[model samples]
Target: MSSERGETVAPDWPHPSLGNDLTPRVAAALAAAIDVPDFGTDVDATLAWAVATGADVATAPLAEAWQLLASTAFVDVGAARIIEPHLDALRILAEAQRDGVAADLSSLGADESSMWGVFAAEGSGMRLTARTSPGGWTISGTKPWCSLATSLTHALVTAWIDDDTRGLFAISLRGPDVVCHEGPWHARGLSQVVSAPIDLDGTRAVPVGGPGWYLSRRGFAEGGVSVAAAWWGAACALLVPLRHAARTERADQIALLHLGEVDAAMWSARASLMAAAEEFSHDGGDTLVASRVRTIVAHAAEQALRSSDHALGPAPLVGDAAHARRVADLGLYLRQHHGERDTARIGRDLVRGPASW
Candidate 1:
């Protein structure tokens, strides 16, 4: 399903891809708010600040800020993209001490991500379902591998009703109708990521836009861009340490060249991302540009990780030091949400179309 604008429709949601205008003010605010971590605990605090500030800012700037914050905070912004629309709800539910509500929505978002998880069964997809009733539609289904399931206030769960009609429901995770089952699966790389399972039996859900919403929207492409932004930040973080090592000659000359190559890749990735961001904001949504950005960021991340390992040698793996932790975290973050899959998709797009596509 593609939009009139030629953007592919996300699996099951409405709204064009994540749209954003990157005003200078918003970008400056985001850059200023992203603080380098002094300790492990600081990562969470920085992430909280980014999420809180991201709501009011323009989408492009927020995306940029999120990338920067994730780099310093060592959180998986890729996973965050899957759950972000509901962050506002989570914040509200958390403020009200409505754990059930927060858990419910978070689960919904997680379910959506899981449907696209690296291990998703072939041909299986998730959707958000909604219908009109006196009260509202009744939503029921299972969402697997929901990342950050415990942090959302609502989820856009897709469902089918009667043949030929699909529905998207913005179901509250906290309400009585929703049920979430925490998972046993965990990853060492992105430990902070809360991917879990959620069950909605008879949750009352509201409609999002209208029927066939996912087929008409470009939100997922925008999400791809967001993920790209975060990966860029992680690459940037790796560059800083690599730069220091190069300057001090802590590593051999060959290692220095590797760092330089990684730095050049990072700059290239950033340039691609900025170009995509501009196109997304100005032309509505362009899957070609978004895919290119995704590919660039993923390659940059891989290069940065490899270079960091080369520059720091076994120190990052052996020591429990901050640098080692950051390096490990970057590895984990890069693996989130099938980064390889995204890169492949971008490659496919590049081969099939012109650079401007």
Candidate 2:
């Protein structure tokens, strides 16, 4: 999509990973595959690509996470968002491997498989009830916003075992009686992710952790920033077109100004991520810092969306399939951050005291 009189096209401006300890094979592969539209790939095939390319990152060394950030940024964000949760599911499964988990999740790359972290969500919650049974446990009730609910082979789900207590279960979605209802998501963006509802009609599951363990884990909040990273990646994807137009579309001087602002915002977001990574590496965990990272990155993402749309105009969204989905996908994905509530929470944390700070 071109705006200037003679400029009939917008050149490709891909994300750059300079000396970031990022994966080489993954980066090259995603760059080549980016020509594909956001919703073009099926969920099962997407998972296969992610597993084959090491997109389902684990939280051991921070470098692996950064590599994931870079690669997903290079790929379609809708796919990135879907692949990341599966990675998180695998990470959790790895943690719960020794605790009587029957399924061999290590076969992620070997088969047509994908996992989901089916935890809490907005509006109607997953009232899933888990009960001790002859084989292991059975979950009843429904889980909401279950992304790839129908397509995924397995999921690390949250289920209530008692009135006030909830537990985590490693369940196979292919099991009998599990019905994945048609998607409740009608959003213009991330429709490819297909967040739907699933009813576990006495589906058997392998127990992972007890009540409160999910949120209480050391990586609970830290893992959240990874979502923010993906958000930042999508936002940065918007920049490539903006940067291209600013450099090529010389008639529009204001476009350069927009690029400048977005560059600064992206810089700040990246710095915050690196700083959070360093903090997590050194201090083990910092929920407060991670929350701040989410707020800052989300704010930058929102700003990038607005600024890029304003600067580059709607031609990209209207004409370019990849650009349109990137914009929409990012717009929807950034909603994971709680907006003003996050900023207020950060402020409250700062105002509270330095004792915990």
Judging by TM-score against the true structure, name the best candidate. 2
> How much is the lDDT of residue 22 in candidate 1?
39
Error of 1 at 35 (Å): 9.4
Instruction: Please write out the lDDT profile of model 2 over residues 18-101, one tens digit for every residue.
Output: 236446555554654444332224566566655555433453466456547545654567667776776676665555543444
The deviation in Å at residue 30 for candidate 1 is: 5.9
lDDT of 1 by residue, 1-357 (tens): 112111111123221112344345445543454342322233344345545454544233434543433332323233333323333332222322322222233434533222221111112454323345786577666666665556544455556654576654556566666666566656555555556667667777654445664434543356556656666665565655566567783567876797789868877876777676667556656776676677777778888888778767785466534455556556776664476676677668767877675
Alpha carbon deviation, residue 199, candidate 1 (Å): 0.3
Best model per lDDT: 2
| Candidate 2 deviant stretches above 4 angstroms | 1-14, 18-21, 24-40, 54-56, 97-114, 350-357
Instruction: Please provide TM-scores, in order, for all candidate models, with all chains considered together.
Output: 0.69, 0.84
Global lDDT of each candidate: 0.51, 0.68
How far is each candidate from the true structure, as Cα RMSD in Å? 11.3, 4.4
